[model samples]
Target chain A: MDLLTNILGAIATIILAFVVGMSYGGIVRKITARVHNRLGPPWYQNFIDAYKLFGKTTAIHHGWMQIMGPAFLMVSSVVTLMFVPVLNNGGWFTNLNFKGDLIFLLYLMVFGPLGMALGAGQTGNPNSAIGVTRGLSQMVGFEIPWVMALVALMIQFNTTTITGLMDVQQMSGTWLMFSSPFAFIAAVLAMLGMFRYSPFDIVGAPTELASGPVSENGGKFLFTMMSSGSIFSFVKLTLYVDLFMGGADNLIILLIKTFSIYMIPVLYGIVSPRYRTEQAIRFFWGWPLFFGILAILYAAIF
Target chain B: MINDKNSQKIVDIIQNWARKHSIWVLAYGTGCGAIEIPPTMTSRYDAERLGVRGAATPRQADVLLVTGYLTTKTLKRVIRVYEQMQDPKFVIGFGSCTINGGMYYDSYNTIKLLDKYLPVDVYINGCMPRPEAVLAGFGKLQEIIAEGRANGAQKYKDNLEWYKANQKKIIPSLLTTDYNW
Candidate 1:
């Protein structure tokens, strides 16, 4: 009975994440269209697109690895979702918030991209190869400040698990956003790259790279990637909410918090232009790196 | 129930509905008519509102928008691109150039009839169709899709030899590697 309930809880969490994430993606598209002064598709457009792609008949693939690419991405996304806590103190929503889960999460997040890189390489498309390199290089660029920020939080709170950090925020009655402003700033800056919005979006560079890594993917392969992408985005946002904004107690607060957090990258991406790989690395290492160090200093001193 | 004709019809209806609402056009600008595409995609026109957006590659695209006059030289590449696209795909012959060849009707290199080489699902008739015309053409395609009438890909499959002969007449050195799939 316990095992069945756990399985059901996991399924519920996956469904919730997929729905919220897909809606957020649609909202971003609408927001982007509105910014450009055009009427956009309805907020459920992503769902329609995903369904269409799912129903599409895949005719060709380079090899087995090409077929496995989306599967790897889906695995990464679902696993990451399983690890994230959706709501604070909510039974069943906390799927696997074990000790030292944050460190495990940092590694798990990159696993999908690397697996995708291998699959893309098998397709033998030059653009996919270039995209994979740029993506990994950009990953290296951003992970530094992101790691520093997390380390600062860990040192200050003296806890390795997300739930422990949440407990600290709850007991203190103040979110970490206020208590550790520099870490938040550094992390948010790293997130701009993590989300791979404009400036940092050189990995895909759709106009130039033929959509980068997924250039050869279509039909069911594309559908899996698309849905996994939505789920992954939700996982990232919920992790942020848990880490910095104080995890929400209910679904409404969770939505509001995650949406507000999502707007940071989406709005920034709209106005900014693309950055070359080196320039993006430089940008992250510059101000965000300095802020990360300051966050460590603040944590150590106080 | 899964194998029943009625159930299959219901599935087709739902699939058509979803397909009609999401059309990813290939961003291959084959000719001068490409200029109008920017405005159509941008704020003033915004084809995205109707679920029409540019896809970056042949693999990802549903609709191949042949923008303008295709010389014998370019037709080879266009045929290759169209073939690379997956099943249930479409082709839109844009501008007067792709139809009767417009001013290029007398030109030795330009192919007059596009449907001779690939099945064109819709044609936007103009020297250069404005953004409004482009959107109208898309609406027509969407209507055809919703009605289960857009079967250009299937038509191409059924009459491959005829289309290949037409293509080979223009580009005698056309490679057959694209047809193997």
Candidate 2:
């Protein structure tokens, strides 16, 4: 019975986490549209996308490379999942709570998208190459802030376990999002951008470049990449919530806080148009960097 | 959960208006309908506020706007992209190229009716529909959405054969019941 509960918990948590990430994204997109004075999709829109992708026939370039594309994405996302303490919040398989673990894991998150981009580039198509390059450039732009924000958290908290950070928050009764308000603000903004939504989403903008690098990836590679992305996103979001909001035995609390952050990108997307590559990098380098550095200073002083 | 970023009164009003306004279009310009998209997006027919910019990629696009006639060569790419786009994604066949294959009616390359393959939401009429005709089609699309004409899964199940037929026509070698790749 205990084993069954554990297994069920893992499964439910994984499913719920993925759904929340997806649904959270959908909600955010909807809210952004509403913010822009337009009615957008219902909350379930993300799931509809997942289902639709499954329905479409998968394609492969070279049978070997195409097979590896989605495989790498899913594997990378799963690796991303391992580092995140989703249900229990302490740590689990491949948890990176050891010295430099948090930093190591954070860097690891970049691989999934990077691998997907490589897979797309190798398809030997110019259009896909353009898309991947754009994606890589966009990822490069946000990489700095993403690291700085975490460094700020690590500096203030003095520990790197995503779980340890959450433990501190629970014990101190103050979330890091609150610990360094500027860091929280900046990281929230950058992390909101981690998935690379609009203004930053220029990397994979389809109409502009035909789904970017991912345009070339198909068949199981596309499937695994997308499938893992969904679940991996859930784990990532759950980790964020657990770190910032504290974990719960019940799922409702999980829903509220995670959904709140998940909506950040969606809301930003609705009101603004996508930026040019130059503009996107400029915003990341200028505004986010200032805030990220300030966050570090604030962490030091406190 | 405890914090409310915007006041309730304002949020409600804005949310209401947003539901009726901005509509993002993917604008998959393959054949000729693609040609008309530029004029509509330019200053004269500016669709910026309505969120009608052409998304170059399928993932972030809200609607897939078929701009012209799809050839056997281009049709495969179109279908693949059409499938890639996220859900709540609408498909608009913007030219006679898509609606009935226009001048290429008897040509082997053209798919007689695009809807036979994908679930088309709005069908604009014209050998090559003008930008004006495109907008009119969009207005109708918004109306259909408002009236709840988008039935996702049902539309897919009903049009499975159509999509399959298209797959065979475009990527014949790839049109297998099982994808080994």
Candidate 3:
């Protein structure tokens, strides 16, 4: 009975993530349009785009790996969501959080991109290959700071579990952003690359690489990629909230925190010019890496 | 079963509605009329307000906008792009040039009639249609999609032989490989 209930809860959480993430995406588009002094599509534009992609009647796939690309991404997003605690007070929202899942969560996050890379490799397009290489390189650059921040928190609190970290935050009455300021800064900086915005969006340079890794994907394949992206964005935001914002006690608060965290990248993307691939790698390794090392040192000393 | 069918119909209606609004156009510019597209997409007209955005590749694009006259060389490439697009796709023949070759009617390289080679869902007839006319063309396409009248993909498939023959008449070298769509 408990297992059945957990499964149902997980499904519900995935659905909620999809809806909220897509809505956030639509809102981001609107905000971007306004920034450009233009009237954008409605806040529900992403939902419409996703639905339309699914509605496309014909699609061409290169092979079996092409079919698995979006599936792997979806699995990774859902699995990451399952491991993260959504609310400060655990219930249905904390569907599948388990002790020491933080390391597993980190690996799962990379798995989707690896899968996508393999699929893109099969497309026989030089652009896809170039995009995948840039994406993987950017991933390596960002993960260093991200992992260091997580490790700093883990060492400081003596807990490798996300819920355990959240619980500590709740008891202290101070969010990690205040307590471990260096780690928070490093994480937020790393997130700019994680969100794949300008300066770090060398992989999917739409005009240059023709939307990069998913260049060959269309119809249902593109739809799957789109939804997976939304869900993954939500999962990443939720992870950040759990780590820094003390996690939300309810859905409204959760949305507020997640949306605010999401804007760090969106707003940053708007103003900045895209960096070349090597320049992006160097950017991540520079200040963000410095901050990550400082965070670890701060945790160790204090 | 009846309930299932009704729900499926509802899904179809919703899907059609969404597809009608979000038209991702291929970023391929074929002729001089391509000059008008940039303004339509930018802040002045902002085609994105109507959910019309530029797509990077033919695979992801929903509409192929062939602007102005297609020279024999360009038509070969355009046809290949058209074939590469997924089902439920559209072709917009922009300007009087695409409609009837415009000033290039006497030119041996320019194709006089575009519909002879590809199924065009909409045509904006102007020497060079303004961005407003381009937006109106998109608006008309949305209406066609909503009414389930955008059957150019199917028409292309049904009349592939004729399209191929007309295409072969111009490009005797046959530069395109069989995409096998």
Give the range of the ten consecutive residues with the poorest summed lDDT in model 1 chain A. Answer: A89-98
How large is the C-alpha RMSD of every model relative to the true structure? 1.2, 10.5, 1.7
Q: Candidate 2 chain A: worst 10 consecutive residues by lDDT? A: A87-96
* DockQ of each model vs. true complex: 0.90, 0.10, 0.85
Which candidate achieves the best TM-score against the true structure? 1
Q: lDDT ranking from best to worst?
A: 1, 3, 2
Best by DockQ: 1
Q: Taking the tens digit of each residue's C-alpha lDDT, what string does model 2 give over A11-49? A: 655565566667765666566646655555576655554
Cα lDDT of model 1 by residue, A1-302, tens digit: 88887789999999998999899999999999999899998999999999999988898768998888889999999999998888898644557778999899899999999889999999999999999999999999899999999999999999999889999998999999999999999999999999998978999999989999999998889999999999999999999999999999988999999999999999999889999999999999999999999999999999
| Cα RMSD, model 3 | 1.7
Of candidates 3 and 2, the better by TM-score: 3
Q: Which candidate, 1 or 3, would have the higher TM-score against the true structure?
A: 1
Query: In candidate 3, which residue pairs get closer than 3 Å at backbone N, Cα or C atoms, i.e. clash?
Result: none
TM-score ranking from best candidate downward: 1, 3, 2
lDDT, model 3: 0.90
Cα TM-score per model: 0.98, 0.66, 0.97
